[model samples]
Target: MLSIAMSTLRERWVAFVVSLVALALGVGIIATIALVMNSALTGFPGQRAALTGTVVLLSVSAGVTGFATVFIVASTFALTVIQRTRELALFRLIGATPQQVRRMIVIEALLLAAIGCVAGVVISLVGAPVLASVLASSGLAPSWFEVSISPVPLVLVCLGGMGLTALSVSVASRRAATIRPTQSLRESAGDPPGARPGRSARTGWGVALLLISLMGMGVVAAVLPELATVPVVYLWVLLTLVAAVALLAPALVLPVLRLLTLPWARGGSAIGTLVRENTLTMARRTAATTLPILITAGMSISLLGALETIGHAQSVEAGERLRADYVLVPEGGPAISAEALDRARKIPGVRIAPLAPTTVQVTGEAGLADGFWGYATDAQRFAAMTSLPLIDGTLEDFGPGGIVVSDIWELGAGQRVTVTPDGGKPVQLTVAAVVGDSAGGGDFYLDVSDTGPRPAEAAYVQAGGEAAAALRERSGELGASLLTKAEWAATVGNSDQGTGVIGMLVTLGIAIVYSCIAIVNTMVMAATARRRDLTLLRLLGATSRQAVAALLAESVVIAAAAMVLATAASAINFAGLLAALTQVVPGATLAVPWAPVLAFAATSALLAILATTLTATAAVRTPAPLSE
Candidate 1:
């Protein structure tokens, strides 16, 4: 059996080679992500603790990193498996038995997995100590992190990754199996769509998926009560992605190609014809590449929307509850000081109302609010000036030591919640009515008296945007911040630290891999199809540059149209995530990060052009097609 398997693989080495390479890249990606995140987070707690000895930051950072990584891994794996269809099909055609083919694929994946795992461990081992040393040198703490490698988790990670690879390879193998053995004599290998599966099965999958989406959304609406809108919305949008990718790919390409003709179709007849002609010919491969992009765009956009909504909501909650023109503070960043407030109240356009601010650590599993101390005063008239709505418990609940909170905190209502106070125990506080004050963006609020006589100073201030600006200008040397509602909106909305840079990095990282591989494959396939055509084009007076342009123009059309689909998917996804956020985060509102989306889309398009520019070499200058 072993001899037969090796002999079969030798004959069908192309598919086997392709499968191994694809699987290696995917498994390597998964293992690397795990390795990177673990290495990054492993030292995070120790570093932060060394600096401040505050354990809370450790939890918060760890939570955020972990949550984002989970989603990133999912997106990466899904993209990886989808790109290996042709290679998988080729394996079945090479006289390898189905079981043997499967084993070969699995073994290839395992080899890659083992290699990736070892590489990752090596990275952590070598890199962690260096990072710790740097932190110590920088005066951060008890002088660096201990070198520790928890073998158990790494082993588990390897096992889990291998399992995913096996499963994905198995599922994708169906495409290969559909190719009739007799067809191997006539065709090179099963292409992107491969052998068409039975219609009934496709229909069954589409219908079942649609139904599941509808049912899931309906169930979410029924079970989550106040949060019903959110989950339902998410379910609906996710279904939209599934349905579009599954049902639309094969049939929709040519139609979209014709549509691309509308631009140059008016006058540049040659360009228009080239664009349409190219797309019509290469839709399947283009569509396959475009599908993953659409999903990522949708997911990223949707999640971004959720985050924006939550931020705005929190702001409104904070603004509505605090009505001060200025948060008079001394020289420090978070806590308020008496000397600072006295000077601030003397400033122009400054009406200091019952000034109050307290340093209290919000303890929640989700870290719903920003990492900081909660501040409160006897309601801001400026907040009223900004039109922050009081949807729940009144601002009247706010007084010295009597605090008000947004309605999202109802979880701890009427119960003693432990909080780290500036100069006291983890005091327990009674629940106050949760309210929406998105205009101010406050995560938590506290009464002045709750401050417990540590100091007589201003922690918060309320002022109009103009007034805030004037104050900053006149006393820019005061070394403090004074922000109006509009400024705050733009500021909080734009803060980079929320989703953090690492999230985008991971997304782009996987996307780059997908784009590179897919482009290479497309070029390879296109070259094969257009061998004679290209030779003819070269003979017909087209320069190498012109040929490159034509190829890129084709790529641009495909990428741009696909990006639009991705954008639309993202929009819907964002709306769904917002609905979920509405229930989970107080004052959560939908936010669309258009700038990032556009930037990303533009980059992908450019990359596509570059891809064609580099790979078009085969068609640009070669007159004779290479004979296999």
Candidate 2:
């Protein structure tokens, strides 16, 4: 039995190759991500110390990016495995035992997985400082960031990935085992493997998951509010997306059918009729492709939402907290002129209240070392006229002997701290309060009289009523500076919310298209191989057109069904991924935008129409002779 199974591999090497390649790609990504994450964890501290500051948000960027990277890799790999169905079917019929099939996939996958791991580790080994340099230039990171892949985890990642690759291949191979040996020995499996979920069935699962996902989130949030926030939100989006795919796919066919039947549609009813009929035919193929579409679409929702959230944090939110409508500083300060301030005041809705201009040395938290930043403000006016929320201490804290720091400034309320403001005297101040800040960036609110860093001073002003445009005009005229709440918001809106979503959509769109092409090619080949059968049908008086339409309708049906299943799967996995991300990334939330989901479903339906039409074109041209 073992020999027979093993022999089948040589006979069907291509099948094993497909699994190996797909599995290796997945393992490679997993290994690389693991290595990077480990290096990130290990190096953050040294990097932290070298760039020591008054505070650090230990839970932000590193964790979040890591989690996202993992999901992107996993989805990519799964899609790859699914695309190569033909090769797998052949091996089973050739007498390959499942165990032997599994081994062949694992061994080959291991080799490729190792190479990817090595490449990732090496790149990280080399790329850290190039990154640090860019950060330093941008004034974001200090000059002393230590970036390198440490020995411990990097090695572990490589080892672990091989194990994981083998495991994934083994699991996937077991499913292929159910393929009837004789049937598979003859030809490839259908584009997608399954049938459609009935409306009730899809709805039941969709509703169940939706409820469970939501309930789980509510419970988690009520119990662990902070941790649950981003995680719960992500799960919510994931569930919603799944339900949309499930509950929506069957319903999707009608729209596609309607689209094909539309009076104003591009092609005439014959082409359109054929297209519509074919859509119902390759339902399985369409559905399989929809899986990738769902991933891409679902991810787009999250990415866009993230960008929007981040952008909002940078702009509208940042501006509201800035509190100062305009700032007027001495010509000698950071250079805001009186004319600029006056012009700002002249703008519509402009109102100027008070100004506080003073200086405080900027130093790292706990006096860790490095350079300094200067804060210019008059304590009394600044405190009274700002939107800064005193979450912890009080306003009395903003003095040479007292202070309030940003939320991320990891210090106890009563802790005493001393720092040489701008390389000056190490003045000690007690923590009075910690103020709330909107954006994740760091800054301090304290009253200190020091001029250590660049003098170029900055003056704060309160202005209302259309002061923004006036400030801009004045800045251009007086050669000074002004930034309005809206202008400032636009400038700082880094994530640009939905702006980046197009890229994700395009990428996903391309993937779905590629899948469609694969389906077309597969169907065309299958039809070509069945020329004798088709010829017999043609002889039986089944018109080539009708035969083509029937085949197309079958494809549409199967693809549609697969699409239904995929939608359901997307909900499950996407939720799991979000939960993991929430555990890993700080402040990362999952939000599903309905528009994108609907768009993807519709897109899949359209592609199925295209694929079916294109696939039938080959067979319709010539009827094969019936005698086999």
Q: Please give each candidate's TM-score.
A: 0.65, 0.53
The number of the candidate with the highest TM-score is 1
* lDDT string, candidate 2, 35-62, tens digits: 4345345667745433432012112222
Model 2 CA deviation exceeding 4 Å by range: 1-98, 111-164, 177-288, 313-316, 327-381, 406-415, 418-426, 436-444, 447-451, 454-460, 463-481, 490-492, 495-628
Worst 10 residues of 2 by lDDT: 53-62
Model 2 TM? 0.53
The Cα error of candidate 1 at residue 101, in Å, is 3.4
lDDT, each prediction: 0.47, 0.46
| Cα-lDDT of candidate 1 | 0.47
Q: What RMSD value applies to candidate 1?
A: 7.5
